[model samples]
Target: MKKILAVLAVGMISSMAHAATVGSQSYKDNIEVGGSMWIPFGPHADSAGLPGVGVKGVALGQLSKISMRSVRKLTEQNPDYGATDGNNVTVVTPPAHGKVAMGNFNFAQLADSNAEVYYGEWTAHNDTAGATRSVYYVGKDKTANMPTSGTATYAVKGINQYSGNNQLNGTFTADFGKNTLKGSLANNALNVGVDAKINTAAASFNGSATAAGKTGTSQGHFFGNNAGSLAGFAKFDDRKLDTAFGGVKK
Candidate 1:
């Protein structure tokens, strides 16, 4: 029985290795790509004409290409290395240029909680050889331990605007921020092609989303009608994923 079990384990390992070999190759190719939201936003975009128009400041860093042909493989060797343990993800790097010359926050996203599941922070190589930058949500609402209904919040998670629930009606920007989602940039990116356009930019923001289990309004603040100021949840829904999020600033 022990020998049989050992053989079975070996077989499983071999199978995984085979799959990993094949999957890694394809995954590397598929994963080594500039995400749809890989624009030059964040602080670098500058808070100048933001919420208005024009350059939206000017993206500090734009991940033009990601070469996953050779990546850091700590997860493969150590089980507890990365949080995801997928061992498929690789560090992302910017090509030649597209990075703004200003304040830091370079690979800030990598250190954020979101990077645990999504890609880790994308450290930049501005000053040194590697800096980090994870994400700049056009919109995402993350609460502290998922608060009850009607709690004022800030901070978004990702770029997925249009988050809906029973009570909450997050009317996202609807334009995907006009930069990556509505301009020549997104229309000409890798993986995310022109067809990847988010045609339905939410026109109406939803306020008051109830918890999936709770019958009463899910307990959260509804960014109601407020002109000139953003009002809506972008990254999450009602199941505690909802919170006050400022999707796109520029």
Candidate 2:
């Protein structure tokens, strides 16, 4: 019986590995469309020591070619990694000119929970040395434990899509009683403000954002003990900017 159980365990591991390998190609193709790649959004635990960090980069002509090959390979290795429309991946560095600048969150890992979202970066290179980097977050919502009436502030990190992955730092405020959320993420290049309605049962929020007289939409979710953390993604309709942001309650 012991030997049988051991063999079954091994088989299960092997089957999972095979599925991941087979699924990666399809997932990559689905996410990368017309020079745009999907990124996951929502609250995530800072597992792997990589809390979500904002990135800034320049767009080079070689970005599309390099990122496609690199991201596919990374997905092949991390079958569990996935992407969604909430955010996007922008290729930054070109390898021929210099070594790709590595960032703090430079590798992909499996999500810590059944519900998942991801953050990522890329390195441009012609050879196999080029690769995409990513991290996963567990999405959690403790509705019962969530405070019914109160206001809290969260410090956030933002990625500016219009300004070559411009990094925006800012804060968000949530009012539980009002079922409303508001915040602004900004840098010298741009500033965006968001207002949304919160759905406590789902531990999520969605609404509109405005920047420089242009309007956009935002969506995100709450995470952790009693919904103590929040994260979101946004995009402008007329402006070339998109953003991802998150922070913990203080």
Compare the candidates by lDDT and give the number of the best one: 2
Candidate 2's residue-wise lDDT over 83-143, tens digit each? Answer: 2222233333323333333222222222324222233332223323323322222122323
What lDDT does each candidate get? 0.21, 0.46
Per residue, candidate 1 scores C-alpha lDDT tens digits across 1-250 of 7975564344334322321011000012111222122112322121111111111122212222211111222222333322222222232233344233211221111123221112112222353432122222111122212212221222222221111111111222223233112111111111111111221123223222322232211111111121112222211222223222222222
The alpha-carbon deviation from the true structure for residue 93 of candidate 1, after best TM-score superposition, in angstroms, is 14
Off by over 4 Å in 1: 1-76, 79-81, 85-120, 124-197, 200-250
Task: Give the total clashing residue pairs for model 1.
Answer: 32
In candidate 2, what residue range of length 10 has the lowest lDDT sum?
A: 18-27
Assess the local accuracy of residue 108 in candidate 2 as a C-alpha lDDT between 0 and 100: 25
lDDT score of residue 171 within candidate 2 = 85
